[model samples]
Target chain A: MSSFVLFTLTGLGLAGLYFLLASGLSLIFGLMSVLNLAHGAFFAAGGYTAWFVMDALDSVPIGLRFIVALLAAGLVGASAGAVIERVLVRRLYGQHVEQILLTIGLGMAAVALMGGWFSYDPRLLTQPDWFGDTTEIAGANVPNNRLLILGVAILFFIGLMTFLKRTRHGLIIRAGVENPSMVRALGIDVSRSFTIVFALGGLLAGVGGALGTVYFNGISPSLGTTQLIFAFIVVVIGGLGSIPGTALASVLVALTQIYVNNYLTSGLGSISVVVLLAGVLLVRPQGLLGKAAP
Target chain B: MKRSSIFLFVVAAGLAVLPFVPIEVPLLFSGPFDTPGTLQVLSVALVLAGLAMSYDMIFGYTGLLSFGHALPFALGVYGTNLLMLEASIPYVLAAAITLGGVIVVSLVLGSVALRTSGVAFAMVTLAFAEAFSILVISDPLRFLGGEEGISLASEQVPDMFRRVVNTRNIYWLALAFTVFTFVVARVVVSSRAGRVFEAIRENEPRVEMMGLAPFPYKLASFTISSGLAALGGTVYLLAVRGANIGTTSADFTLSILVMVVLGGAGKLWGAAIGGFIYGILNLRLSTVATSNAIDNLPEWLSGPLSEPLFVLGVLFVILVMYAPGGLSSLATKPSFGRATRRS
Candidate 1:
């Protein structure tokens, strides 16, 4: 029972990162149709940014330093996302396929640049003392950081839900996903919302990266990329553009991975996740929450 | 056209006779042109050139953007290497078996992945490739080789292709493969099925309206292209002398896309040249990165420049945004920057 509880909680922690990255990716692909291959790069940048900021905050209290680092990472991600959209992605505006190619190039370059600045070697980040402690829950010693991640993810999910439901920009984004031209016909300029959606995604991924660095105990140049593949799986398994679907699928995929990896052989977990993806595709090609193809 | 064919023949002839030449090019080669070092680099170039052209069949001609092209290539290298080293199969038989395996594997994966169209198709294929990659890297079964892939057994390799001195023979095989792929791609592109592929790319609904099932044609393109990539994989193992985890990576698939797009997607020769140059540049740039000229520059400017992927990646982005037609179009014609997707 202790092991099961530990596994479930830890699994939920991992799901937090996937949710952050996949939610952003789904929103971008939903409204813009750009896969944003560079989304991983943004995640990496956030990791690096938080790492650097916290590393330099020798004067600050450990707890306070982490809060500052996390916010900085999110800020850096948002700025970069907005800039990429305004400068590079906006130029190829209606050419969604071309946008994919462009993002691929950007992703490659950004990751390479990160690798160059920081060596391929993994760098362990500085975390607070309490974060290193374990919290006993139901006789299971759960890492405090794992609980922190789960808490953050839940808060972000509620925040995302609220923003999407309450805001006018959210309405425009949702409508854009249904039909861009129809939204435009109603005299709404989704062009501005495009940048907002991109930034919003970057903010979530960036924040996730910071927490990922904390969860994994270190950050490497390739960290974002390895995680990105799983995030893509979650996004596809959940319906693209559906926030609630993304949230639900993240938990399912993460739990399955953790449970299998713990109970079964080491590698079967990854293979099974893929098998799960294939099974889903075979049964419902449009995805579980996605509507039929237009 | 006649003049261009003659020019092509001249270039092909020059490349074939390169092994016998004793002369050296200064910075690019560490030794004479025919030496093993130069030949290995040239051989890799030829192998990738062939691989790029094969990718073009599905991506450029059939207009399917597959992120899992690396799967067949990785299988080709890993399968042959696994058979020879672990199972003790001879090189000749192993390669033949692997090629057969590639055909079946690609066919099955293609049919399932092709069920979804466009971006969904790309993601599903990627998931499959990533799964295979994890299998190879993690080594669920010990024969797959965890993390570090296996090396070739000298005894299993035939007498003609062993040791560093025999690099020339491998180079010749790569050349043969490239020429074979070029011919096959050209022949198929001009054939009836090829027309259907282009039509499907132009407009899938229209192609369906024309009483042709696009599924079979798309599947055919996927199989043929992956078969050639697998064949190149066998040759790649011979040239590089081992199968590591890098070839199976999604990044490797992206590089293939870069090569095809950089050269000119629809044009076979464009992909060949683009991949060939990319190989040389990829190898040479590593050498250049450590040079005094690069190291002397300010860290701010030189850091990103030192990474080879940064250069090629930026080049890819610039090309996509400004010149969608690629290098071939500069000579043949210009295309307004638009990624090839059905209207």
Candidate 2:
């Protein structure tokens, strides 16, 4: 029972990272109708940036360093995303194939740059002293870092939901997702909205990557490709442009992956998740929470 | 002869004589190709051309953006290798079996993948490919040989594919296979079903409203495309004398896509041209990067720049941004003729 609880917590912690990664992808797809394949590059950039910051600020307080690293990651990711959107994504509106090719090319460039800059060796992010400690929860010994990640994920989920539901900008984004032409007709400047959404998505991915680096104890240039595939699966399974759907789908995928890895072989875990993605896509093309296209 | 047939004949004639042609590169442009290297690169290019044309069949003609194309191609390679090496099957029978397996796998994958359209379809195919790759690398059956992959000796294959004994045989085989693939692709694109594929691409709903079932046509195109891709893989294995995990990787799939797009999608000849350009560029660029040609640069700057894939990535981005229509468009533009007509 304790092991079960422990596994479940581990699954939820992983699900939190997936949620952060997929939410941005889902949001961008919903608002801009652009499947930003380079979103994984943003995640990778965030991880690498966080690692650099942590190394540079080694003399600072551990907690302070952690916060600074995360913020830096988010900022760097957002700026990269903004640049990509302004320069490339803006011109390829409604051209899915072009967008896909462009983003994929950009992604390859980003990964290559990372490899060139950082070398191929994986780097470890130093965890804070408090984060390193373990905590007892419901008779199960759990790592405090896992609990912290879970807390952060929940907060992010609530914050994103509130932002989307309550803020005018969020309302505009939702409106744009539903009907871009209608929003444009109302003088919302859909292009600007797209840029903002893209930045925000990048920020989320960055934060997720930073957190993931600490959790996984390492970061590498190849992280982007692996995480990108997972994000794709999550977004597809959850539904294309649905935030709530993404959250649900992330939990489902993460839990399944964790359970399979723990109980079965690690290789089977990846296979199972892929199978799950195929099954979900076949059964519900629109995804669990996504609305059908008109 | 008809114009198209004449064009085909010219292409075949050029390919037939290409291996015998002595390529002389100036000192400034000298990198990898001497003579044998050029032939080897040309043979690989021919195989890739076939692969790229197959990709064009689905993505360009059928309007299906499948990300798991490498699956069928790799399956063909591994299937042929396994049948010949392990099962001790004859070359013809093994190839036939591999083709059969490819068709069955394509039918199964296409059925599930075609349930979704657009982005969902791409993801679903990717998922299946990832699963297949993982399984192959994991090698639970032990036949896959894990990361070591599988290699076949000259004795394992038929007389024609014995690269060790006679390298030119494999080269000719690849060239023949490439031409065959192009002809088949050309026929399909000009056939009645090909018209339906284009119609579906332009507007699926309208075609559906017209009482034409797009699903069957798509499946047929996908199956045919997979078969061709498998054939390319067979040629690749025979020429290279091996199959590895990289054959089924996402990178390989993306590379095939890049070749198709760079040649201009929906054009069979364009894909072939694009494949040749990409293959040649990749080989030459990598050779240049590693050579002492850029030794003047600082270590930090030269280290990354020396990698061919990085250069390719930058080129890919630039090409997509500036010339999304690919190299084929440049050749077919008729800009000079248009200017003269305007004058």
Candidate 3:
């Protein structure tokens, strides 16, 4: 019973990271109709940036450095997103193939540049001392970091839901997702809103990447491609443009992966998630929480 | 003869005689037929051209943006390797068997993937490819050889595939396959089925409303393309004498996509040209970076310049942005000219 509880907690903790990555991708896809293939690059960049910050700020307290690293990652990702949106993505609005090719090119460029600069070596980020300790939860010992990640993920979920329901900007994004032409006809700056949403997505991805490095123990240039594939699975399983769907799908995928990993080989765990994704795609093409296509 | 036919003959003749002609270019480049090294690069390019042409059939002609095309290609490579190395099958027999296997696999994949259209199709295919890749690398069956993959040398297999002695023979074989791919692709694009494919690409719903089943057409195109890609993979394995996990990676798929798009989608000749250019650049860029010329460059500038993929990425973006029609358009009239004339 304790083992089951432990597995569930671990699954939830993993789901938190998936949620952050997939939500951004889902949000961006919903609002802009642009599939940002370079989304993983931003995630990797965030993690790399955080690593750089932590390394450079070795004299500072670990907790303080961690906070700074997360912020820096978000900011850097946002800036990159803004520039890419303004310069390249702005032109290829309705051309899906062109957008895919362009974004893929950008992704390859980003990864190659990162590889050139960082030398393709994996870098580890140090977690705070407190994060290294474990605590008893319902008679099962749980890592402090996992609990912390779960807590943060819940807060993000609530905050995001509230923002979408209550805030003006969030409302505009939702409206755009539902009907961009209608929103534009009503004189809302849909394009500007798209830019903001893209940046926000990048910001979330960055935070996820940075936090992931601390949790997973290392960051590498290939992380962009790896994370991108995961993000794709999450978004596809969750349903495109559906936040709640993404959240639900992430948890499902994470849990499936955890149980599979525990019972089978680690490699089989990866394959199982992909199989799950395929099953979802075959059964519910629109995703679990997504609306049917018109 | 018609202008197009004459032009085709001339191009085919040039390619046929290229390996025999010992032409050499200056420092910036070398002819494909000039040296052994360049010939090897050109051979790889020809195989890639075949792959690119196959990709063009589905993506360029049929309008399906599949991300799992590498699956068939990888299957062909592994299939050929297994038959030749383990079963001691002849090269021709192994290739035929592998091609058949790839078609069956592709049909199965197409049935699942064709259920979804547009972006969903792409994602589903990608998922399948990723699953296949993981399974191969995981080596659950113990036949896949895992990350190190399998090698096909004379010691391991037959004498025909010996790298040193059969370099020229492999080069010619790759060329033959490339030409065959291009001709077949051209024939398909001009055939009745190709018309249906174009119609599907232009508007699937309208085709369905017109009482034509788009699914069968799409599946047929996918199957044909997969077969051709499998052939390309067989040739690639023959030339390189090896098959690895990277052959089935997303990166390989991206490279094929880049080649097809860069050459100009829907144009078989353009895809072939694009593959050749991409292959040459990929090989030559690394050589250039490590050559004596780069040694004179400043340290800071030299570091990033040494990576070929960086340059390829930049080129891909620039080409997509400025010239969507790719090098094929440049060979003809400007795209803007065509647009203005159409209007």
Q: Pick the candidate with the highest DockQ.
A: 1
Model 2, position B306, has a per-residue lDDT of 63
* Per-prediction TM-score to the true structure, in the order listed: 0.97, 0.94, 0.95
TM-score ranking, best first: 1, 3, 2
Highest lDDT: give the candidate number.
1
lDDT of 3 by residue, A1-294 (tens): 777778888889888888888898899888877788888889899999999998899999988898999899989888888888888988877776787889889888788888877778898887688887888888888888788777777877888888888999999999999998999999988888878888888888888888778678789977868767777888888989998988998899888888887867766877899888768767987888877866
The lDDT, on a scale of 0 to 1, for candidate 1 is 0.88
Query: Candidate 1 residues B94-163, lDDT tens each?
Result: 9999999999999999999999988888888888999988888888778876778777666899988897
Better of 2 and 3 by TM-score: 3
Cα lDDT for residue A68, candidate 3: 96
Worst 10 residues of 3 chain B by lDDT: B334-343
The DockQ-based CAPRI class assigned to model 1 is medium
The CAPRI class of candidate 2 is: medium
Candidate 2: stretches off by over 4 Å:
A129-133, B26-36, B163-165, B334-343
lDDT for each residue of candidate 2 in B1-343, tens digit (9 for 90 to 100) = 7897799789888878765666666432442333555566677888998899999999878888898899999998889888888888887688888999999989988998999888888878888887888888887667887888888744667776664435667778888888899889888988999999988887899999999999999999999999999988888887667888888877778788888888888788888888877877766775677667675788677766766567777787787777777777677763321111110
Candidate 3 lDDT tens digits, B182-300? 88988898899999998887778899999999999999999999999999888888777788788887777888889988898878888889998898888788777778677678765
